[model samples]
Every structure is written in structure tokens, then in C-alpha cells.
Target: MNAQTKQDLLISIPNLSGYDSETRVLMERACVSERGNGPVAYGACLNRQIASLQGAPGIPNLSGYDSETRLLMERACVSERGNGPVAYGACLSRQIASLQGAPGIPNLSGYDNETRLLMERACISERGNGPVAYGACLNRQIASLQGATGIPNLSGYDNETRLLVERACISERGNGPVAYGACLRRQIDSLSTLPGSQ
Candidate 1:
């Protein structure tokens, strides 16, 4: 090997494509993006993917965990199950609020406006006309239902996660709604002990 002329290197940042493509888009928007619009788009895209979610949509010739990750997230938050379902749907909502897009309302507690809104929404969900529904979300969120921090009730749901449950509970019925109510109870109890919220 001999050293002679110096070569200039050009790096190409490829475009994000494929199914869970929304995840890549969202992450990019979440980090480098300066405006809420970009993040908002990512959020909407993720939401659509979640809504039309059929297990995990497989993308041909695509690599990475975007699709799989989104699938896991949906499984945690979206899927329609009998009694055992992941609380990812609630997590998604909270995540949206925490992100650049769904910053939620203002003048509250936690890291940002989104966190506060999430807590308040949780309160409404728990204190409202449903405890079972809240439980459904919490079953997956709370660690053994022994009580958690940042949750709305007796549950220990993180800020963003609590908001996720609140969002899920907002539009559901029957067993789904009942589960949400339980989740809310868990949150309510948890929040009741928080430093500022409790």
C-alpha cells in the first residue's frame, strides 16, 4: 500500500422507507426537527399505522426495527384482546404528547406541557365513569399493580405512559372501556401520591 493523494469522502444519509417507516420518520423528527410540524406528521403517520395495524406489516427489502417496533408498540397499545393486552396504545398517546407534535396543553406539571395534560387526562379517566378500562391499560404498565409513580391512580404509570392510557380510554366501550377504568384507578392512586400532582 502507498499513500499519495487524499480522497474526499461523501456520506449519504438514505431516505427512510418501508412499513414501520413511520418510526424512522418520527425519530428523525423527534431529534433533528426544529418545528412541531415534522414531529406532528410523524405522530400522525404512526397513529395511522397503529389504526390500520394488522399484526406487524412486513416491508419487503427493508431492514431495522421500525416496522417491528411499531408492531410491538401497537401490540402494547392498540390490539383488541380479551383480558391480557399490552398497554402500548396508552404509551403511544403519551409519547405523542411528549414529542414535538402533541405537546398537549400548557401550565401544568412534569417535564413539559404534554406531561401535565397527560396527568390531567388520566385524572378524568380514573375519576370519571370508568375504572375497569383504566385497569386494562395499567395491567401492562404498572409493575404488579403494587402501585407506581406518575400514574393517575394507584397504578405507577410514567407520565407519557399515563397519557397513553388516557387517550385509549377516551374512545372505547364494553370490556375495553372497563379495562381503561381500571387503568385510571391505578393512575389516580399513583398520582394522589406524587410530589406536585398528588
Candidate 2:
């Protein structure tokens, strides 16, 4: 992150000492990488964390799920450290959708190898949170990739150049999938500027 962005984040969340080191790091990274809206993103993240920690009760009710599914949902949502209600509810919702065999979750089978690899890595990072959470993570990251702007089309590039671009993009992934996608976009844009890269 740039010095100015870092300064802005610290100024916004002046007392991050209460959070563990890992969460603090993730919070800062998520905030800064949130489509360049650091302060607003940080505030949202902070609110979520606080709400979750306090058991603020805005989470989805278990009225419809069966006993086993409700138990699984609770375990999946609470298994992750520092999970907020928004994320927890999202996990529950995804689990419900998965149980119903929902059709909207994009199939990654058709994606190019490099893009698939990055998406896999992003989801793998959430594997510890259980199957429901992992599925949720995959859905979220794939949506992010699909919705993101400026992702260059790689059909014109040869295998070697594509691999190089993939490695370059992954190397610049500072925090998570959003930043990784941004890096991929930037690397491809940089290639366009080269004299004979076409």
C-alpha cells in the first residue's frame, strides 16, 4: 500500500490493538484493496467485526433449515475466527443454495488455467473454514473476477507469454483475490504498452 493510504487507514482505525495481528492485517488489506476506497471500506469492515464480536443478532434465522443442516450451518459460520454476521449470513445462504443445488454459482471448468489457478488459490485460503465456507468463498471470488473491470482478454497471447503474465500477476498479489485481480489487469495493461508485445 502507498504511504498515504496506510496513513489514512491508521488514522481511521486508530485502535486496532484489540484485534489479533492476523485480523488486523486482513482488515487493513481488505480496506485498502476495496476498489481504492480505503476509509469507507475500513469503516464497514470495522462495523462488521464489532457487530460479530458483540453478537449483534442481525444474522439469518435457522427457521427453515433442518436440525442437521442448521447445526452444520452454525459450525461452518462460527468455525472461522472473527466472522461477522454479514459473512456468517452469507455462508448460511450459500449452504442453503448449495443444498438446493442452486444454478447461479459459476462453474470454473471453462476458465483459462491461469485464471482458474488464481481463483483456486483464493478459495483454498478459506478451506479451513469448512465445506460451506469454502464454497461460499469460491462463489464470492468468482463473482468478483467476473464483475471486475479492466481484466484483459488473454486469447491473443501465446502459452509462454500467458504463463509469464500469470506469474507476474500472482507475484504482485499483495493481500487477496481483489488485489490479485487488479494486479492481473495491470500486468496485462503493461504488456499492451510494450513495443512488440502484440
Candidate 3:
């Protein structure tokens, strides 16, 4: 693709919050190298790369991926580290942290299910106990939580806090308590049953 077209493609992709200048340059190179291929084809290649990095299941069919979806896949791939699977998880956590503080992502519904899930988890995690504090302490806590063998004590947390933690664990980390869904369901049911709920 031409420089302008490449720039446009980069701009169109969502969840590029974690890519630094060097990473962006790499993505640009990848796009240029695959410029002969159509957008869909290029997107598919990027998605496959991401799947490899995440150790996720088979490569998704990217024929249906729009520019935005393709961008997310690209981000996923570019986030991969040489250290292996744990590094990939850490990269994702950092990406999620950066996106949490960014402006609201428009056309969120336009993203595919997986991308939507990622964005939702990021947003939920951003809603901390009180004001959102994107500090080292929070980052350390999230990292430690991801590495912990058991669930942390959340008894003192309110419904929102619990919900955020549960969603992050289930969706982002791929590890959550079996009762998480049931707990969330019960909370939702209780809220809806309360007076004035629609």
C-alpha cells in the first residue's frame, strides 16, 4: 500500500493503545509488504499472527474482518513478546490498561465478538474501587492477580468492584471462579427486582 493508504489503515484500526513508535513502524512494514494483497487478505495474515501469539485456537476467518477488526488482530500480534505465553498475557494486560484511559471507542458494536469482549473487559477493569488510578500500584496488583494461584478475597468489595474483577478474570485472563457467572447473574436479578428498575 502507498504511504497514505498505510497511514489510513493504521488510523482505522482500533485498540492500538499499546503499540509504541517502533511497533507501529513494524506494523507499517507488514502492511507494506502485504500491500499486494487486498485488505481482507492482509487482515487475515495479521489475525493468524495474533492467534499464534496468544496461543489461541485456530486462526479466525478474517474474510469477515473489517478494518477495525483487523487492527485489533494486528495489535494482538504486535504485542507478542519473545519471552513466550506469559509475556503475551502481560502485553495484553498493558494494552488493556492503556485503552482503559483513552477516549471512548466509537463503533464498538461494529467490532467482532472477541474484540468486543476485550474492550468490555478493559473498560470494566478501568472502573476501580473509587477514582480510576492508572498508577504503578494498580498495574502491580493486576500483574500479581494474574499470577496468583487462587482467587483473592473480594468480600469487602461492592457489586461493581466484584463484577469488574470477575469479568477481567473470566474474559481477559481466561481464569475465573466457576461461581462468577452465577454471582453476576444473581446480582443482576437482584438489581432488576429492586424498586424503580425498568
Against the true structure, whose TM-score is highest? 2
Q: lDDT of model 1 at residue 183?
A: 60
**Cα lDDT computed for each candidate against the true fold:** 0.39, 0.61, 0.45
Q: 2 or 3: which has the higher TM-score?
A: 2
Residue-pair clashes per candidate, as listed? 40, 0, 0
- lDDT digits (tens) for residues 1-198 of candidate 2: 999988877766547688656556544544454436656666766655655546433455777755544665666656432344445556666566665653323467877775666666766655544455556666876677656663567777899988888788766453345667687778788878999866
Candidate 1: worst-modelled 10 consecutive residues by lDDT: 4-13
Q: Which candidate leads the pack in lDDT?
A: 2
Q: Write the per-residue lDDT of candidate 3 for residues 1-198, one digit (tens) a residue.
A: 799998766644433346454433444454455546766556655544444445433223334545543345335545353323334445545444554555323444554454344434544443332122223323433344353333335576687867665665464332222233345455545656769978
Error of 3 at 164 (Å): 80
Q: What is candidate 1's lDDT per residue for 39-101, written digit by digit as tens?
A: 445445444444433563222222332453334334444332211111233354433333233
Go through the candidates in order and give the C-alpha RMSD of each one to the true structure.
Answer: 19.5, 17.0, 18.7
Worst 10 residues of 2 by lDDT: 79-88
Candidate 3, superposed: residue stretches over 4 Å from native: 1-15, 55-198
- In model 3, residue pairs whose N, Cα or C atoms come closer than 3 Å (at least 3 residues apart or on different chains), thus clashing, are none
